[model samples]
Target: GASSSVFSASSLASSLLSPFSSAVGLASSGFVSAAFSFTGDSTSFFTSSATTSACSVLGPLQHADYFGLGKLLSVRELFEARVHLGHKEGLLNDLMRPYLFGSRLGYHVIDLDKTLQHLFCALNFIAHVAYRNGIILFVTRHQQTAHMVEETARESHEFAHTRWWRPGLFTNSTAQFGTVTRLPDTVILLSTLDSVFEEHLAVKECNKLLIPTVAIMDTNCDPRLITYPIPGNDDTPAAIQLYCHLFKTAILRGKERRKKDEEAAARQQQEAAGTASDASKQPTSA
Candidate 1:
């Protein structure tokens, strides 16, 4: 209920990203546990059972949210980011009717419970892709948040396409850029709609190319067009920042996991090589 557009107030603005202030200032799993517990243990979406530690059920130690990305942001924090606030009820799209938490002062309030499930799934997908070194492209249209989006991509060592979407970027890559020019394995659309009446061309282009998409869409936007639609207030800078923070964290976690895996493989190979050399030296005497 705090985001009154921009959150210009000094106190609110200062605490806007207290939990996600930096890469090291990451949010703890405590908040996540508390939030999920409050919501009647709705964590089944993230894992088989994250909270239950009974002897019968060991629970999945390595689950999708193993990175704790799901725990990084609580449902209450979603309200703080103004993600629950949607466009006016008059602009509601019938396709998005299911995501409504009901209208508040004529504007739609998105169901944060649903948002949590979809957001976790989307983040998990992103992290999995990143772990394989998959190319990810951030797409946005509004100049207001373009710089932030681009910066987020750069920090995560990914690509960003904030300018006009050339018609043949995906369908006709050879003609649009070059024959060797590669397309991203995944696309994250910060905003799916180009304007009030039209959806972004990249949405269709990615769908045609069979490239997966993770999109942040408002209540006025259609979720069917997106491979994974995260319902929230896509137009707000605060919300955009929150989205960027969560995604960037996921990417970094994925990369970190990849590094660890590579190191482990290398160590195993070295140990095997050493073992073979020792055996060769001892076999001559035998």
Candidate 2:
């Protein structure tokens, strides 16, 4: 009776701790091995199995998150998004001087005009790539805004590494992970420079691979590092969301445009074939 009670308590504890673990049968053995062994084996099994499931499910979405490219982002939206806010003047980059309006208190304020200009260039570049069916990888190392980045990436139907920028993701793709057949054509960095960590290895790898990068660079970040550096507040949620929405819009626009072009090409081919057939059927004017 005592053994049954002990086993029941252990089983209840295990169930409470691991909801994923299967129910264990009552062990008649009063020995500690009978009780502890099943618990240990079951815990390891469920833990490993759950991890595998998560990895398999989140490997990559089946399709890009294309909710219709929507419309082009506007300056008024940028103004409202508060994307102009930046770090202190001492943190400012000289090359980014063109993108600054002036300083308020101690912080450097970003110029909405230049931001819009750069944004358009960046979005247009992204749209062009998407139109050609190129892959984009959105990367962020900041935990605070990582969820937003992942959500944006999923909605945009692109790949993302919000958790951590695994070093050599591009350079060691096939070698690091043998089954990996492809790497992203472009990388969009949510945070160009992480204050907490060392330089993002993904940035260097992208450069080495010659894969173009679009980065939301804070005033403290070096503009020369990325291919398309958009000087803005990479720390704020609102600013990141604005950029994400615009990029998603651009990607959708490009995909839509590509689809239209494809459809048009198909129609033209059909029409040309019909015209040739009609000519063949026409009586010769002798």
How far is 8's C-alpha from truth in model 1 (Å)? Answer: 42
In every candidate, how many clashes are there? 0, 3
The lDDT for every candidate, in the order shown, is 0.75, 0.66
- For all predicted structures, in order, the TM-scores are 0.78, 0.72
* Worst-scoring 10-residue span by lDDT in model 1: 4-13
Predicted structure 1, TM vs. truth: 0.78
- Root-mean-square deviation per candidate: 10.7, 24.5
Best by TM-score: 1
Best by lDDT: 1
- Residue 48, model 2, lDDT: 29
- Tens digits of per-residue lDDT, candidate 1, 111-178, equal 99778767876787788778879999999997899999999999999999998887878999998775
lDDT of 1 at 123: 83
